[model samples]
Target: MDSVDLQVLAAARRWAAEGRRFAWVTVARTWGSAPRPPGSWLALRDDGRVEGSVSGGCVEDDLIARMRGNRLGGGQPFILAYGVTQEEAVRYGLPCGGTLELVVEPSPDPAQLEDLAARLGQHQLTQRQVDIASGTVTIAAAERGDALSWDGGRLITVHGPRWRLLIIGAGQVSRYLAHMALALDYEIIVCDPRKEYGPGWDVPGTRLVTTLPDDTLFALEPDARLAVVALTHDPKLDDMVLMEALKLPAFYIGAIGSRLNNAKRRDRLARYFDLSEQELARLRGPVGLAIGSRTPPEIALAILAEMTAVKNGVAVPLRDAVAEP
Candidate 1:
């Protein structure tokens, strides 16, 4: 979930705790150009106040009007559709007659929402199921080991910390990578034991760790939402942490090197670390797409683009072997 969802949920909990009644609405489905995607949520107070948004403004306005007239109350959930016609679409600012579907559940059990918040605080992906007939909700643990599964009956809300990037070096390339990753809402940590690089390593919203790379990995205990990149090109600094990260469930593991250097590194890993072919294959040496990136920023962009693709479960195409003239 995003920050907006967190805020709305927190508000809902506060309202419920204060003995105020509110309804929770979720945009469960959309066709064409809905303002918000599925899983977008809104909380409506008893007096027609709302947090978050499902459409531009018209939908909220219409919902509020209904609420004031006492037509949308009681403790039951119902599905609503809007913008089925061009005029309605224009009125709601939906592009090209787009339609949106919402699930409105009144007086949601605050305890269940609070439980979800607690799980999210621990950085755990969770799935919440609401029985339409019984109006009961159940929360279950979710895994990032595989692609997200969308169940028609269950509202799967991913609850966790934002994605993270751990760069094992704090050089120029690391700075570029950190900047790009932050724009993508990733928490970044750059580690370097070298005092020269460590002294000037300051990036906003990025933590700088001057500890040894191996110890840093142990402390982090990286999970599937974390990606580790080794940009120092030093075996002493990079190899140990690479081994540690590979042992964990980090979604992307990569290192910067030439093809010849990568081959040598793999040989060393196989000889000393007992890494199998499959395990070694997980290490993307000569990291990033074959974009002919020669500068620090360009290379960083390529690496982050590749990481994003992997996180989204998309395949990276092999670059053409034919050299460009």
Candidate 2:
């Protein structure tokens, strides 16, 4: 789930609390090209109010009209498809013969939605299963790997953070990064055994561990969905963790520092730590994009921007190109 979907959830809950009738729309499938991915959410209120999006503009317009006219859904849930034909695609402004299949629930249970929100708040991966004909819904615990599944009759969507970010050091950059990463569907864990930093570390939605960086990394047993960022700027702490992190299958392992410092760090890892060239290659030193970030917040933004690009499989410039050689 991204920030857009989270905002949609919040808006839907607010409307529900006001006792307003609303329908929930979810993008079930898409073909060719889509403005949004499958599993995106949209909430349509009774009085033509809308939150979230399923398409760029045209689809939302039609849904708004239908919602205002009380024709979006009957008693039970139904499937709606748009841009099936070339003319329909053109009419809906879908790019390259794009098509979107959506599931519309006329009367979603507020209690169930609340339960889902609560589970997500607790950092638990949850699965929501909806029956198309009966409008029955079930919520259960889901695995990190579980994804949205849509059969012809049933739709199951997974919610909560599927990714985890472990930040070493509770310094200024870690504070900004941890706060921002929450909205990107990341379960943040900040590790720092330094007592001086522990008292000031108070970012919500993040767990702070008072353990050595290397010890914390050893306990984490990092997988592909995990991203480890070293921000202590202390080679004693950062390098110890990197020695273990470089050999793992983590999706991203980065350390923040100057280009000269990172080059020196790389050399130390290779010479003393016995890290292979292949293992050393995995390190993203001088982490984050070259956005000319000078402050802590800007640095945080650049780091997440780079992380998102890498996570999405978008090719980014090599570190050498972005940093002074």
Question: Which candidate gets the maximum lDDT versus the true structure?
Answer: 2
lDDT of each: 0.82, 0.88
Error of 1 at 304 (Å): 1.8
> Each model's TM-score?
0.77, 0.81
**lDDT per residue as tens, model 2, 214-285:** 889878778777899999888998999999999998888899888888999999999999999999988888
Q: Each candidate: how many clashes? A: 0, 0
* Model 1 bad stretches (over 4 Å): 7-22, 30-37, 44-72, 83-99, 109-111, 143-156, 318-325
Poorest 10 consecutive residues by lDDT, candidate 1: 316-325
* Local lDDT at 238 for model 2: 93
Error of 1 at 257 (Å): 3.3
Error of 1 at 182 (Å): 3.0
Cα RMSD for candidates in order? 4.2, 3.5
